[model samples]
Target: MEPDSYHRIYVERTLALIKPDAIHRSEEIEDVILKAGFAVLQNRKLQLSPEQCSDFYADQYGKYFFPNLTAFMSSGPIIALTLARSNAIAHWKSLMGPVNSTKARETHPECLRAKYGTTDLKNALHGSESFDAAEREIKFMFPNSVIEPLPSREETEEYLSKHVNPTLVRGLTELCKHKPLNPCVWLAHWLMKNCPNMPQIVVEEAEDKK
Candidate 1:
């Protein structure tokens, strides 16, 4: 057997959706996400048009529940997220559990869908099924966004453990532990330090000012 040149951890990004039926539970879900150690790269809320919904779920276009699914998706506002973690695509799906809420409740009662989903069509969340789909969905939700290619686990872990994690812990600890005036001002500065290419208006404006 030949040895591979590089170790690929598939330390990738994935798209997560707080569907209309569960957008009300967004805060709770996000808390779970942070506690679970996933990094939320970006997020936005929008109401999709029926046409947009159809396009997004094109793979299911001919399915029996397609119409109702599209209608429900377009019915209210949804929160789209670009999340990053090692093994993100599969990990997010595991967190979301089954597409069928009833089955999810039966088998994975603590999963996001089991707790919040109402039905298969009105499932409380959505996760891209694969790395390719995740890239597509993240691009769809965040046009003009650039997701940097991640390094392998060996490189990431060594660097983070030796350099990144300590600094981050100190910084985040300071931010959370102290009550500062206009905390957002400090947070914006922190985000710039960590994510200089975030594609946010604030990032752009800061660059322009510089």
Candidate 2:
């Protein structure tokens, strides 16, 4: 691939959480984010319940600081931002600096945690560690947003040929035959009823073994 195309193909998205302690400095934080070449695709302020915080940080559930972490996270509203750029996860992590504020101050004095954070536990920000974590975290914070990566050109063409085109072609053929007054409406209804790619219905046949 050409250099530009390769760079374009590697565009990534990561989730960044402005923790409660830094919510008041959100404007400054956002200015930093923008300056660092991140596109803020979506953002929201959320006041999470302890249960929600626990669920969001499920990987840390059994850790010693779990309870305190959950309680602190639930204490106030934090801003969740969907940031996109090339190498976004690593870049955001670098910008957030060390999780321990004192360590961040020593090693990365210009980092957000060093500038805004007070302690190790309240590091004033959170960033996903990897692509999978980014996907899960983004979905957890922005449930309704579609975070799936776009399929490759080959994949898109194959899917259109195998699934979408056949249904649309058949629908159009039927529409032409009947000459319906509202052709779009007729084709839409026909596709819904006749499309072979209808969503599957899964039935749970047994209770949980556990």
Candidate 3:
């Protein structure tokens, strides 16, 4: 099921980038993310090529910081996470603090960047600044992400209530318990144990009738 049906209730998803500088502290940062009530919908550790990094940050092109920013982004492996929450776009950015992390440390000591970042170029995290940017960034990171250009209201509501809400509750409950070191690993085990029978949907092709 697609996940973009939240114009009314504000369930949103955003991309949170754990930049190269913070890759070493990935687990600590992830613990912070989970404790902050954000769900990790998808996670991957990938090394971006220069071209990919440039295209991803195209909006900053021609700016003074663009070249250095892109170079840093492509320098090493980084963690890309699809984080979801009630207001994920803003919430994730708030967790990341400002682009310049030395200032973030002085002002917002609890922020991710402040804890892990050394400089603006070495900033530990990246977050989508707006709703449109969130959507576009998610697509850039996950090109084959399910297309939900327009999800029917009723179906979307049904899916969320039936699947998303309950799983979130259960996930949160597990997170609160004495658990595995890795949240994603715990989730994988939970899914394998619980999902005995996955429903298979069959789309019937139309046929001519006499």
Candidate 4:
């Protein structure tokens, strides 16, 4: 195929959580996810601290059930998944059905909640509500990843060439010549001191003595 004839397909990513109540059913839930066509990009099982649970659901902090919700979430290990698909957020939301398990069973019989969830607060799974929430939740769960809305290659190259490369080259050269025991620390200090936009520290000179 000709270069111009090629088309790029972009995939969307969202965060999914198998909360404590349904943690034992993680493998089954994952099977459902894969069957529904979502690629699990990252998966981890971890127990959240009470503080972490509180922070994760910060928006619901003042609600009547907030304390109990946090307690339940921190009670056991939950599985965090980074799901990718064309519309992963909406798909996962549909899969999870209503927040209440009773409602889910009545209205959406095939949903995950209907099968595993106990109540609204103990909903078996959680899906990101929007793009911003996806980004935040994904970052919270997987700290090392770089996510969407990233700068293009051209933009990244331009920035490195204009601002970073020159200083980086000089720093590396000095690092090689001096061979400091703490090379990383030395390079960091060098870059800070030699940065193009670093603010000047103006020291006032005392007036000449009479």
**Top of the candidates by lDDT:** 2
- The alpha-carbon lDDT assigned to residue 97 of candidate 4 equals 96
lDDT for 171 in candidate 3 is 66
Write the residue-wise lDDT of candidate 1 on 116-180 in tens digits: 99888888999998877887888888888887756655676676566656666766777898767
Where's the lowest-lDDT run of ten residues in candidate 1? 1-10
lDDT of the candidates, in the order given: 0.83, 0.89, 0.83, 0.87
Q: Give the CA lDDT, 0 to 100, for residue 203 in model 3.
A: 100
lDDT of 3 by residue, 26-145 (tens): 999999999989999888889999999999999999999988989999999999888987787878888888888899999999888899999988989999988789889888888876
Worst 10 residues of 3 by lDDT: 1-10
Note the clash tally of each candidate. Answer: 0, 0, 0, 0
TM-score of each predicted structure versus truth: 0.68, 0.70, 0.67, 0.66
lDDT of 4 by residue, 80-146 (tens): 9999876678889999999999889999999999999989988899999987898889999988877
lDDT tens per residue, model 2, 78-108: 9999999878999999999999999999999
User: lDDT-based ranking, best first?
Assistant: 2, 4, 3, 1
Candidate 1 contains a number of clashing pairs equal to 0
Q: Which residue pairs show collisions in model 4?
A: none
